[model samples]
Target: MMASALLAGSALALSACVASLAVGAAGMAARGVAGTPTNNEQAHPAAATDCSTRASHYGKVSIIDVEQRSPSKIVVWGTADDGKQRRSFECSYGTKITGFKLRPIASPR
Candidate 1:
């Protein structure tokens, strides 16, 4: 009898879990159907925090171009400096950035 009761309790718990998963999937689909940014109340870009901020003095950044080299790789080209001088920098993002390619410039753009 105890074994039967345990089995019943296990079945009930599993059912609850399945129901919760279905609800979660439905909510996600509804968000897609609504065609909204989903975070309209938020005042920042979702990936703003993901961007690297290690440039010198946090100088102005202008994205010259962005290219997706692969499914998980992106190449970013731009220039940054602390007003003393300007430099062109290219940053590659994949599993990790194993390189730093920077070239000095005579002026800011």
Candidate 2:
């Protein structure tokens, strides 16, 4: 009987531990701490606007990706009207905007 009681106690403790772990994981996910961006998390507004304005000179620019390189710098990748040509724009807050055209590498025939 004592052995049975011990087994039941152990099972309850294990289950409680697992339940707490599951709850903690769920809470982390809900709080966007699981390495995933929530809906509210997006590229900096000023960075996006600056990139768009600078890239507009190329043509009707379509932004592909926006990445924050640092607290004050953001890099935006995009394609112009042709879509074949890719470009990258780097915007540093309170500084100049730099743009670069990404050239496609020619494959060996």
Best by lDDT: 2
Per-residue lDDT over 45-68 for candidate 2, one digit per residue giving the tens place of the 0 to 100 score: 665677677767766777777776
lDDT of 2 at 36: 40
lDDT of 1 by residue, 8-103 (tens): 999999999999999999999998897653322231221122233534434765556555555555566767766776777776655445344677
What total of clashing residue pairs does each candidate reach? 0, 0
**Pairs in steric clash, model 1:** none
| Residue 87's lDDT in candidate 1 | 75
Q: After superposition, how far is residue 54 of candidate 2 from its true place, in Å?
A: 1.2
The candidate that achieves the highest TM-score relative to the unseen native structure: 1
TM-score of predicted structure 2:
0.41
